[model samples]
Structures are given as structure tokens and as C-alpha cells.
Target: MKMRDISESQRQFALLGGIFAAALVVSLIMGWILFPSLAYARKAQPINYNPPLHVEQIGITCDTCHFFYEDGSWAGIPTLETCVDCHSDIIGASPEEEKFVNEYVKKNREVKWALYVKQPECVSFSHSSHVRMAKIACETCHGPQGHSDPKDYLANRITNYSYVVYDPRVPLNAFTIIRDKGETVWGTMRMDECTACHRSRGTSTACFICHK
Candidate 1:
């Protein structure tokens, strides 16, 4: 009778261990893999923009389109007027270029480019300070977008926030994974990265500084 009781207890222990292991595996797969995959929805740009081709081949610079206004406020994205200067006619055999000329340029309509790194309305960020005064390279925060494939961009379904790291090299697994205990792996803009960058540069982390 004692032997049977011992055998029963061991069986229960083994079953519980197996169940716990299975639950842990399921949790990790669901939280790390499944949730992230579902959290973002892929969307295409109006046109497939090749930055490196323009930059390297045509000698176009970042500020050529993304220029600063005389008032020092940054021109976040180029306007249709700016694009019209070059794209008045299709310069290349690219179907995207043709589409741009016919659909937007011909219509005199602005290309509604999706914006990444849109901060909350309460937060006031000065790109001039960071770009001009600090002399920080655009890649420092935005990643090497010049070399990135525009199609790799993804938007978070919940927040509608687009990711800046358009690199095909970086895996999307970084989208929503946490390592060890508290280390967050990320591909998109987050408050932690912002605060961390500021702290590293000895910039102000005070709420009022950003939350104007």
C-alpha cells in the first residue's frame, strides 16, 4: 500500500512538472512571438522611395528635401512643391515615379507620406537643437534609413505609430521581446530609448522640458 502511494505521488509530481513546462513554453511563444506578430500591421508607402539611389547616385543630400525653415523649425517631410522641382516629369523608368507624376504631381496634390517618430501632442521636440547644435547624426535615432528598404517599415496597430528602422537586416523579433529580466528589445521608438539617449548626452530628462 505504501509503495502504491509513493508511486501515485511521483506520478502526480511528474505530471505537474510536465504541465508547468508546457505552460511556460506556451506563454513564451504567445507573449514573445504571437503577440508581436499580431500587434503590427504591414502597410505600403504611396511610392517605394529609394534614398540611397538618390543620395549616392544623384548626389542628393538629406537636407535637400528635409530642409529647415528660416524660423529654425524643421520641415519634417518634403512638400509636393519640393518634389515637383525634380519630379515634374518622370526622370526614370520606375513605375513608382510614373505613378507619382500621374497620380500626385499631375493632380498638384501632396503625397501624404506617413510619418514616423510622431511624439505626443504635449511634447515639443526641436530638431534644430538636436541636429544643428548637438550635431547628432540623423542615423543616431532614426537608424540608417538611407540604406534601409522602405518596404520594411511597420506600423503598430494599437498606437498607429510607424517604425523608423526600415532596415531589412534587423529582424522584427526585436519588436516586442524582453531579455533576461528587464532588458527590452525594440525596433520602434519608445520613451525608454528617448530618455536613455538624453541621459547619455546629459540632456534634460525633466518632464517640463519635453512636455510643454
Candidate 2:
């Protein structure tokens, strides 16, 4: 009778342990799948800038708006002067353009465009090195920007340590193989993503390579 009771207790313990393990696995799977959406906030753009029209109709390229500095850094946003050079006369007569001209250009103030891809201050990214030396296309990291319609807005969230988002637009190429559902892994300019690319390419994965 004593032996049977002991065996029954052991069996119950084993069953409970198995159930807990299964629950843990399920929780991990669900968290991995659903955490990204829960982690960030998505918002609409204040002003719409059509990339397709500029690229297709007007024959403008990415570099026309987002210029590169001489020192391998990127001038991500175009100055008001750059826009006013052509927009002074209202080429299209669109409301957005008119607003831009009247409100910003005439006022001699720069349009405060929302930045989507913001890197941390401790990191250094060289656009000219990639663009000029690597011969990497801008679309490689920025997605099909030349053809993509202006994004409604960007998603972002504040972490205790930093600001970041998991962008799904990064393409899976030879330079970057890290992917989640055919897109780059949590497409925030995280160290893991950069190190993964460097590791894959046989480049230096030094701590200071990206970090300041």
C-alpha cells in the first residue's frame, strides 16, 4: 500500500511537470510571434510626400532629396532651399506642395519631416562608405523607396535603454541574411543585426566598429 502511494505521487509530479513544460513552450511561441506589435506605436505622417510621382513622373531620384555629405555622412533631410529652388513657382499646384511653399518656403522655415530611421547617438553609420565604396544601392536598406508610396507614418517605441522599432521593410540580401518571415530581424538598427551582417560577410565584428 505504501509503495503504491509513493508511485502515484511520483506519477502526479511527473504529469504536473510535463504540463508546466508544455505551457512554457506555448507561452514562448506566442510571445515571440506577438511581442513586436505590442512593443511599438504606429502613427500617420503629418504631411504626405509622394515618392512614386517624384521618381516616376518627375524623374527624381532618392539622392535628389536626401543628399550625401562630402565626409561619408548622409544629409538625410533636404533643406528648405533645396525644395524652394524648384517649388518656388508651384510646379504641380497640389495642396501639399502649396502648403509647403506658402507655409514653409515663403516663411523661410524648414519643414519638420518626421525621421523614420534614427540611429542611436553612440553609433556611427557611413552612408558614403556604403554608397561609394560598397556600391550598395540605397534601396537595399531603405526598401523600394524610389517606387514605394510615401509611408503613412513610422512606428517607434521608447525602451528603457534606447529608442527602436522592428521594421519589416528591410530586404533579405547577401549583405544581410538575418530574417524573420522573409524580412530583416526586428529591423531596428540594433547591434545584433549589424554584427550578423558583418559575421556573414567576413568583416570585423568589433565592438567599436559600430559603437562610439
**Top candidate (TM-score):** 1
Report the lDDT tens digits of candidate 2 across residue range 1-212. 45445677888999999999999998987676455545545554555777678899989888887887776678877887787778886667689877777778788887776655667788888778768877878756665555655444334456412221234365322223223422432233566667776788787878887789
What lDDT is obtained when candidate 2 is compared to the true structure?
0.63
Q: Each prediction's TM-score against the native?
A: 0.80, 0.68
> How badly does each model clash, as a count of residue pairs?
0, 0
Relative to the true structure, how large is the alpha-carbon lDDT of every model? 0.74, 0.63
Q: Which ten residues in a row have the lowest lDDT in candidate 2?
A: 159-168
User: What is the overall TM-score of model 1 with all chains considered together?
Assistant: 0.80
Model 2: how far residue 32 lies from native, Å: 9.4
RMSD of each: 4.2, 6.5
The residue-by-residue lDDT of candidate 1 on 1-212, one tens digit each, is 35445677888999999999999999999998798888877666788878878877888778999999999999888999999989899997989889999999999998878766667677788889899999998877666666646664567788776654454554544353234112322244567877888999999899887778
